[model samples]
Target: MMNFTNQISTATDPAKIVDELAQGKAEDYNIGFLFVSGLSNTAMAEVIALLRKRLKVDHLLGCTCAGIIGSEAEIERLPASTLILGKLPGVKILPFSLNQTQFDDFQQVDDWLQFFNVFPNENPKFLILPDPFLFDMHEFLSGLNQVYPGCPVIGGLASGAMQPRENLLFINNESFEEGIVGVALVGNFSVSTIVSQGCRPIGQSYIVTRAENNIIYTLAGRPFIQVLEEVLQKATARDRLLAQEAIFLGIAMDEYTHNFKRGDFLIRTVIALDQSTGAGVITDYAKAGQTVQFHVRDAETATEDLNELLLSHRKKEQNKKPLGALVFSCNGRGENLFREKNHDISIIQKCVGPVPAAGFFCAGEIGPVGGSNFLHGFTNSIALFYPEEETAA
Candidate 1:
C-alpha cells in the first residue's frame, strides 16, 4: 500500500515549524520531501535537523524556493515550509547528488548507470532539483534522455536566490548550495506527468519554409513578420492587446502530427523581431518544414490550460486516482500573474480531488511533452503518483 501526508507551517521560528509538522500520527515514512521559502540558511538547516530527528525518514530530498505549495494552500514570499512524507511499500528509492565536476564528467549511458547504481531496465522515474546558476540543465536533461530513453524526469530549478550558493538543496542529512540533488524511484509505483505551458494558440498553424537556428525568416513562404501581422489582424481585440507583450511561438514537437492544436507544440517566448529583415527570434531553434504557430498568454488562458490538462488526466486515469503529486510551477506565475493567491495549487486540488501534494514555485519547471523532457517557463509541471497495478488498469 502507498500513503502520503502533507503539512505546511508559516511559523517564523524553525523549531515552531518543525513542531507543527510533527503533530500528526507518525508513520514509517520511507521518503520525504521538504520545501522551504523565505527562511534563512541557518534556520533551514535547523529545520532539516529537527525533521530528521522527528520523522526519522531514511530518504529525504527537497530544496528552497520563492514560494511553497502544500495540500491546502500556497504561501508566496513568506517564511514558510511544507513537508510531504510517504509510505511507499515495494518502491526502491535511490537518492543521489551530483557536483558540477561530476555532472560534467558524465558522457555516456554507462556513466549514468554506474553513478546511480541502477539499470535502464529498472524503469526509474526521477525527481530532481538543480541550482539554476551552477548547472547546465539543458546538457543534463539531454544526457538523461539518451541514457534512460523513455523514462519520465520531473522537478524544477531551485528558486528564490539571486546568486549561486544562496539556494539550498537537501538530500538526507546533508545540504548543498550548489549542484543537483535528486532521487530515482523504481518498482511498484507509477507516475503520470502533466506539463502546462499556459498559452493558447492565437493563429492558424503554419509550416516554416525558411529558418536558421532560433531565427525564423519565413512561414508558409511569407515573411515571418508579415505572417505574424496577418495573424494579429485576425485575432480578437483581447488577443491583439495581449500579443503586444505576451506573444510566443510554438514549435510542433512531432513533425508527423498532421493537425496541431493546443498542447501539440512546444511553447517558446518570442524574444525579438527584426522588422527591417522581416524575421523573428524565439527562445528555441526552428527549422524548415517544421510547424509553427503564434500563441498568447494571460490569466484566463493559463487557468483554462491547466484545467483542461488536469481534467484530461483525471478522465484517462479514472480507475486509479492519484494518491499524491509533486508540482513544479514557474515562479512567474502565482499571485503575480494570476492576480490571486493559491491559484495553481487550488486548481490542482479541485481537479485532482485534494490528493496530498507539495512543491515550490520554481525558476524553471521540468516535465515531458511529446515523450521528451524540456525545461519550461511560465508553466506548471506536475508528477502524480499512484500504485503500479493501477497503471496497468
Candidate 2:
C-alpha cells in the first residue's frame, strides 16, 4: 500500500512544525518529508532534527523555499513552511545527489542510483530535486529522460533563495551548494504522473524550413524574420506589442502527434529574435522540417491552462486519481505572474479535491510536453501516485 500526507505550518518555530506533523503521521512504513518554505536555515535545520527524533525514520530530507504547498491550500507568497510526507508501505527510499559536472558522468551518477535501484520491483518512480543553483536542469532533465526512459521522474527545482547561488539542495541530512538531490520511491506501487502546463494555443502551427542546432533560420521556406513578422500580425491586440516578452515558440517533435492541440506545444523560451532578420533563438535542438508555431501567454491563458488540465482529469474519475500530487511549477508563475493571490493552488484544489500536494516554485519546471518530458519554464508538473492494489493501470 502507498499513502502520502502533507502539512503546512505558519509557526515561526521549525520544531513546532515538525511536532505538529509527526502527530498526524502513520508509522507503518518508511517515511520521507520534503520540507520547504521556512525563513531560517538554522531554524529549518532545527525542524529536521526535531522530525528525525519524533518520527525516528532513517530518511528525512527537503530544503528551504520562498513558500510551500500542501493540501492544495497554502501561503501562495509569504513566510511559511510546507511538508510533503509519504508512507511507502512496501517501497524502499534511496537518497542521492548530483553536480552539473557529475551529470556528465552517468556511471558516477548510477553508482548513486544503486541504492535506489530496487529492480524486479519494476518501474519505480523517482522523486527528484535538482540544485537550480549549480546544475543546468534543462540538460540534466534530458539526460534523465535518456537514461530512465518511461520510468517516471517527478518533483521540481527547490525554491526559496533570492539568488541563484543561495538555492539549497539537500540529501537525507546534508546540504549541497551545487548538486541535485532526491529519493527513489521503489516498490510495488505503479506511479502515474501528469504535467499540467497552464497555457493555451493562441495561433496555428508553422513549419521550420531552415534551422541550426538551437536557432530557427526560417519557417515555411522563408526567412525566419519574415516568418515571425507574419506570425506577429495575427496575435491579439493586447499581446501584439509584448510579442518579445509574451511570444514563445512551440516546436513539434517526432514523439507526439502532428495535429496541434491546445496543450500539445513543447513550449520553449524565446531567447532572442532578429527584428531585422526574423530569426528566433530557443533552448532546444531545432532542425529543418520540425513543426513550429508562435504562441503567447498572459494571465488568462495561464489560468485557463490550469483549469483545462484539472477539469480533464476530474472528468475521468472512474479510476482513482493521485493519492498526492507533487506540483513543480515555475518561479515565473505564482502571484508575481498571476493577477490574483493563490491562483495556481486554488485551481488545483478546485479540481483535485485537496489530496496532499506540496512543492515550491522552481527556477525551471520539468514536465512532458507533446510526447516527451523536458525541463520546462512557466509550467507545472503534478505527479499522481495510487496504491498498486488500488489502481487499474
lDDT of each: 0.88, 0.69
Residue pairs in clash, model 1 = none
Tell me the lDDT of model 2 at 344. Answer: 80
lDDT of 2 by residue, 158-251 (tens): 6767666576666666877667778767667755556765555556677788888898888887887676777668777766756656667877
lDDT tens digits by residue: candidate 1, 314-379: 888874578889999999999999999899988998888669999999999898887777889999
In model 2, which residue pairs have backbone atoms overlapping below 3 Å?
A: 65-159, 65-160, 66-160, 224-278, 225-277, 225-278
* Error in Å for residue 40 of model 1: 0.8
Task: Give the Cα error of residue 284 in candidate 2, in Å.
Answer: 2.5
Model 2 scores a TM of 0.89
Which regions of candidate 1 deviate over 4 angstroms? 389-393
Residue 52 local lDDT, model 1: 88
Assess candidate 1 and give its TM-score to the true structure: 0.96
TM-score of every candidate relative to the true structure: 0.96, 0.89
* Total clashing pairs for each candidate: 0, 6
